[model samples]
Target: MADTVFFVTKASGKQEAFDLGKLQHSLKRAGAPPSAMPEIEEAVQKMLYPGISTREIYRKAFSLLRKASPHMAARYKLKKAIMELGPSGFPFEKYVGKLLDFEGYDTQVGKIVQGHCVPHEIDVIALKDEQHFMIECKYHSEQNRKCDVKIPLYIHARFLDVEKMWQQRPGHDHKFHQGWIVTNTRFTDAAIQYGNCAGLRLISWNYPRKESLKKRIDRSGLHPLTCLTTLTKKEKQQLLDQGLVLCRELHRDLNQLRSVGVSEARLKKVEQEVRLLCEPESPIL
Candidate 1:
C-alpha cells in the first residue's frame, strides 16, 4: 500500500488523510471474509477523490459487501439503517423498547403515567426484577445531529417530578425508579456532562465508547426492520407503519411481508438475511 494523499471528509465536516487500516478494521468488525478484503480495497482505491465524504466511502463499501455477503453488509450498515427508522421518533422508541425486551426486561412504549406535579408521557419504560427505568428516546435522522444538554435538563426535571409522586404514594417506597435518555445519534459533550452530574443515565450510538447503543443492539441481536436490504424503501416503511419494528419480529411473522405485497421469493431472501444478522454471535465494535 502506498501513502494515499487524498483526504476523506468525516460526518462532522472534518477532513483527514484516508487510512486503509480504518477501512479494514470496519470490514473485519462486520465479519467480512478475508478474501473479500483485497477486492473491497481495490474498489475503494479506484473511487478515491480528494475530500470524498466518509458516507460515500461507506456506501461504496456496503454495495460491494452486499454482493459478497448480505449478512456482513447488514452488520456494516447497522448505524445508517437505524437512521432510516425515522422521519419520526415513534418507530425508534418502539425499536428501543424491543431491544430492551431482548435484554430480558419487560418493556413498554408510549405510556402515560401520573407524576407528582404533573402527568407525564413516557417514551419507553422497562422493568426487571424490582427495578424500573423510564426512558426518553431521542432520534435524529441526520448523522451529525446530536442530543444536547437541554434535553437531559428537561428530562431530569420530569424525572424528579415523577420521583416525588412515587415517594409520596404508600407502599411505592420499596420500588426503585431511574431515568434514562437513549438516542440513536451521539450525545454532545455538555449533554454527557449534564447527565453525569445530574445522575441520569445517557445512552447514545457511540457514547461510552466500547459499550455503545450500536454495540448493545448488535450484542442482543435485536436489529430493527429497516436494516433489511432485500426490501425496498416503500416496503420497509410499510412494515414500520404496520408496527413491525424489530427484524426479529419480521422473522417471527414473515407473512407480514407477504401481506404487504413482497414477492414470495424476496420474502424468503429477507428471512434468511434477517436470521443471519440477528444471530447471537454477530460481531460489533
Candidate 2:
C-alpha cells in the first residue's frame, strides 16, 4: 500500500532484516504470557519483513493485536495468543536491553545530565561519567543493493528531540552526546547531512570491499534500468533494487536489444548519459 517497491539487500534478497528467534527471546524476556508467542510469531511470518528491525517487528505485532477482529477465531484470538505466550509481557523492555549492549555503547544510552527529555519507549538510557549516549538499532532489509531513508530519520528524530529539550530546559544541559543510526541499507544524502549537522553517527550498510557492489549487479539474473534519470519515482524505487549498483548490469541487459546483433545507437547514448550519474557526489537524494 505504501509504495510496494521494497528496497532489498542483494546478498540475501530480503526486504528487511528481522530475526524471529531474537524476537521470541525478547518476548520471553519481557515476561509475555506463554500463550502469545505462537500467535505473534505467526503474525510475524505472515506480515512482517524478515529483514526489518526488532523494534519495528514488535510494533507491527502489537498493532496487529490492536486491530484484530474478534469474530473470526483465527483473526480474533491471534493477538490474545501473543500476549499470553511470553514471560515478559512487552517486548519493548527486552529490546531496550538489546540496544544497550549494541555495538560498544553498553549501558550508556541515556541522558548525560539532567533536564534532558525523558526517553519514551526507547531501548536504553545510560548516564555515566557525565556523557550521554543514545543508540537506536534499526533492522533493515538485508539485501545489499536497496535504499532506505527511514533508519537515519529515526535516529535524527531522537537526537533532535534531546537537543531541543536540553535547549529549552537549562539546569543540567547534558549536551546530548551522540545518536547512533545504524541500518542494513544505504542512507539518503539528507539523512546523512542532517545527522552530521546534529553530531549523530549515521552508520549505513557497510560490507568489506571483498568485491565492488557493481560486480554483484552484473552477475544477478535480472533486467537492469538503462535510463535511470528518466525513470519515474516508482521505476527508480524498483531500480534501487539493483539498478543503482552498476551500469555494467544495465549495459548487459540492454545488449539484449541486439539479440541478432542489431545496434540501437540511441540506447548507447542513453547508457553514456547514465554513466555520468555513477559519480560519488551525485545527488542521489
Candidate 3:
C-alpha cells in the first residue's frame, strides 16, 4: 500500500504537498532545541489533513513551541511580527531604519529629499562611508501579497530622479550608491529580475538567499516587540505606539512595559523572553 499525501494551502491559496522537512527547517532556524523536535513533529503530523492552511499549521507548531520555549516561539513568529508593525507603512519604514542603524549606518526614516524634477519622500536613507542607499519599504499585512515588478520600476525611476539631484551636490556625486526595496513579504520573480537588471537592491522576507531580511534580523538580534508571545495584542500596540519597536529596547528598559500597565509579576516573564530573544548573536551585514 502507498502512503497518502496531504496537500497544504499556502497563503497565496496555492496547494502543495505538505513537506515536514520545511517545518523542521523553520524550527531549526527558530533555534529550537534538538530534543524538542520529535514531539513537535509528531504533534504536527497528527494534526495534518488535506487542504489544511499553512497558517493553521504554523499556529499549531507555534503553540507547541511556545510551550517548549517562549524565546524560540518568538523567533519563529518573526515574519508575522513584522506585519504587525503596520496598518500604515510608517512604522515599518522606521523599523527598517532601525535595522540599518544597528549595522552602523546613519539612517533617517521618512526623510524628504529633493529630486531633479521634484521632491520625493524616501522611506529610509542609509548612509555609511561613501554608500548612500535610498530604501523603499513595502509593508504588507497579508502574507500572500507580494512586491511585484511595478514596485521596483517605480522605485527605480524615483531613485534616478533623486540621484540626478544628488550627483549635482558637491560631495554626493560619487556618494549616492544604490536604491533598495525592503518588504516584510516576498517579491515576484519578475520583480527580482527587474531589480537585478536595473541595479536596484531588492530585499524581501526570504529573498536574496543568504542575505535576506530574516537572516539579517536573526544575526542582529533585532526581533520586534510584536514577536513576544507573552504580550497581548493591546500591549504590543501600546509599546509600538510609544515608538518602542525592538526587543532589545524592552530588554534595556523595563519602564516601557510598566507604562503599558504590565504588572510587576508579569514584567519578569516578559523581561526573560526579551532577554533571551535579544541575546547577542552574529554580526549584521
Candidate 4:
C-alpha cells in the first residue's frame, strides 16, 4: 500500500491532519443526518498540503464546506476569526492580559457579550481587584494597515455605547473602568496624546523581533502589492498605516559600536571571522 499523506496547517505543524472525526461528530450532533458524514469525511481527508497557514486552512476548509452548506460555513468563519482575534491568539489582547496579571489584576481572558454595540462579537474585559478594564484590542501587522485608524473609531464607538450598556444598573458607570487600545507598533506621539484625551488608552507595546520579514519579502522580488497603487483613498490611508518590522536586535549594540577606530589588526580579525563562517563544519577529536 502507498504511504498516506496528511494535510497540515502551519499554526499546528507540518504533519497535522484535519480532524475528520470531529467534523463528522459535530455534523451529526447538529442534526446533520448520518448519511452526510461520509461525504464530509471524504472532503476533509482530501485537503492535502505540504505546509499551510492557519488562515489558509480556514479559507480552504470553509470553501470546501460552503459548497454543500453555506450557512454552517458562514458561521464557522465568524467563530474562527473571533478566536484568532481574541487574547489566546493575537498579541494585543494576549499582551494586555499578561501585563494585567503581572500587575496583580485578576483577569478573565475572553467574556462574550452580545450587544448592538459590539457587532464584532466580544470585548476582552479585565478586573484589577476592584476596578474593571474594558479593552478594545486591535492588532495590525506591517501586512495590513487598516487597524491603525479603525481602532480609534472603535474606541469612539465603545465610549458612546458605555452608558447604554450600564444605564440599567444605576450609577454603575465606574464598573467599566479604563479603555485600552493595545497594538504591536508605535504610533505618532500626537496620536497617542489624542487617544489619551479622548478616553481611549493607546497601549503601543513593541514586540521583540529577530529577522526582518520585509527584507525577506522584498528579496523574493514578488510585486505582490503592485496594484495597491490603485487602492481607494480610504484604502490607501489604511495601507500607509502598516509599518514594516525590522530588527532591533541589541539595544546595547548601537552604544557599544560608537565611533570605533578600525585598526589593520581589527580588519584582519573581521576577515578571519567571515572566513570561519564560510568554512565547513567538522567533527572534532
Candidate 5:
C-alpha cells in the first residue's frame, strides 16, 4: 500500500523508511520510461519485507530496466559503476580528468607538485582561462561511507601549501586558484561546513544542490566505460587498465575491444550499445 510504512536496510547497516517517491525519481532520472513505472513499483512493493536491503531493491529495479532498455539500465548503474572504477582509484582520477577535458579544461591526473610545506600528489589539476584547480579525489568502494570533516581539513591544509607555491609561479599573479575535494559519496555536514568556511570547494555525489558530481556527468554525457552492461567485469577492468575509461573511447575505437579478444559478434553488440550510449540526447525544451 502507498500508505504502508516499511523500512529498508541501507548499506551502512542503518534502517530507514522506504519512500516510493525516491525510487520513482531515480528511475526517471535513469530515463526509465513512464509506462514501466507501475510495473516496477508494484513488483518492488510486493518484495518489501521488514528490512529489505536497498541493494536488493536496486537489483530488482535494474533487472527490470535492463529488460526495457540496457542503456537506461546502464545509466541507473552509474553510481555503482563509479565505485567499480577502483580499488586503486586511479581510473576515477583519470575519469575526472577526462570530464574536465571534455569541458575544454587542460587537465592532468596523478601529478606530483611541490607544496610550500612538502611535496603533495594532486589527484587532478585542471586549468582553463587563467583559472587553476587543485582537485583531490576521495574514492570509496562502499556506498554508505561519507567523507567526514577530517577529509576536508586535511585537503585544505595540503591545498594551502600547494597554492602558496603555485601563486608564486610566474604569470600567476592574477590567476584564480582553488582547492577542491571530489568524492563519489556524500559528505558529512561538518565536512561541508569546513570546506565552505575554508574556501575549499567540495563536490560530492549530491552536494552543492545543483552542481553535484552526478549532475556534471549527466550534463556532459561522459558516462564511464564501467557503465556499459555489454561488457563483463574483467573486460571493463582491462579497458580501464589500458586507459580507456569512457564509453566514448570504445565508440571511437572498437579495436580496444578486439585487443582484449572480444569476438566480432560480441564486439558488434558492444558497438551497438556504445552507439546508443554515446549518441547525444536532444535537449528538453
Candidate 6:
C-alpha cells in the first residue's frame, strides 16, 4: 500500500491526515451496510488528494453511499443537511419543536409573550409533566461559527424577566420554568461554562459531549425533512413552507408529498428512506 498520503482540511481551517478507520466508524454509525464499506473506502482512496476539504470528501462519500443505501447516506449527512433547514433560524426552531413533540412534549414555536421588563419572542416552548422549557434556537448557516457566551447571557436575561413576570402574578409558580439554548453548531467554551454556571440547558451539535443535540435527535428518530436524499430542493421547500418539518411527519402523510407535486415514484422512494431513518434505535448517550 504505497499510495500517496493525503490530508483533509476541516471546517475550522485545520488540516489533518485522512484516516480510513475514522471514515469506517462514521459509516457504521450511519448504518451503512458492512458489505459496502470496502467498496466505499476504495472509491474514497481514489478521490483523495492533498488539501482536499473534508466537505468535499463527505460529498464524495455521500454520493457513493446513496447508490448502496440512500437511508445511510442521508443519515451520514445529517449534520450538514440540517444547515439547509433555513435562510433563518425559524425553520430550525420548528424542527426542534417537532423533535420535542416526539419526546412526548407539547411544543409551541415562534410565540410572543410579555415579560416583566419587555416582550420576548420565544423560539420554542416545550411543556411536559408540568415542566416548561423556553428554548432559544441558534441556527448557523456556516459550520465554522459557534454560539458564544453572549447568546446564553441574552437568553438567560430574557428568561429571568419572564420568570419575574410569572412570580409577580399571584398563583403563578416560577419553579416550572426552565431556559434552554440549542444550536445547530457547537458552542464556545465560555458559552458552555456560563450555561452550566447559570443553570441554563445548552444543547449543541457536539456540546454536552455525550448527550449532544445530534445524539438526542437520533435517539428520538426525529430527523428533519432535509435529511432525505429523495426530495428535490423545491419539494423540500414546499414541505417546509407547509410546516412539515420532520421526516416522520412527511412519512406519515404521503398525500402531502403528492399534494406538493412529488411524483408517485419519488414519493414511494422517499417513504422507504423515511421509514428506515426513523426506525426505533437503542437510546444514545
Candidate 3 lDDT over 30-144, as tens digits, reads: 8887888999998988888889999999999999999999999999998899999977867788888888998899999888999999999999989899998899999999999
Q: Model 1, 1-285: lDDT tens per residue?
A: 367688999998989999999999889988898999899999998899999999999999999999999988987888888999878889999888888887899998999989987899999989898777889999999888988799999999999988888777777688888899999888899999999999899999977876679778768877778878888899989888898888878777878889889897777788899889777774555
Q: Residue 227: error of model 5 in Å?
A: 0.8
RMSD of each: 1.7, 21.6, 2.0, 21.9, 1.6, 2.0
RMSD score of candidate 6 (Å):
2.0
Backbone clashes, candidate 6 = 0
Please give the range of 10 consecutive residues that has the lowest summed lDDT in model 2. 69-78
Q: List, residue by residue over 183-272, the lDDT tens digit for candidate 6.
A: 999899999999999999999997777778887777777888899999898988888888878888877878888988988877778889
Clashes of each: 0, 38, 0, 0, 0, 0
TM-score of each: 0.94, 0.31, 0.95, 0.36, 0.95, 0.92
The TM-score of candidate 3 is: 0.95
Give the candidate order by descending lDDT.
5, 3, 1, 6, 4, 2
Native-to-model Cα distance after best TM-score fit, residue 171 in candidate 3, in Å: 1.7
Worst 10 residues of 4 by lDDT: 243-252
Q: Ranking by TM-score, best first?
A: 5, 3, 1, 6, 4, 2
Error of 6 at 39 (Å): 1.1
Error of 1 at 268 (Å): 2.8
| Model 1 misplacement above 4 A | 282-285
The numbered model that scores best in lDDT is: 5
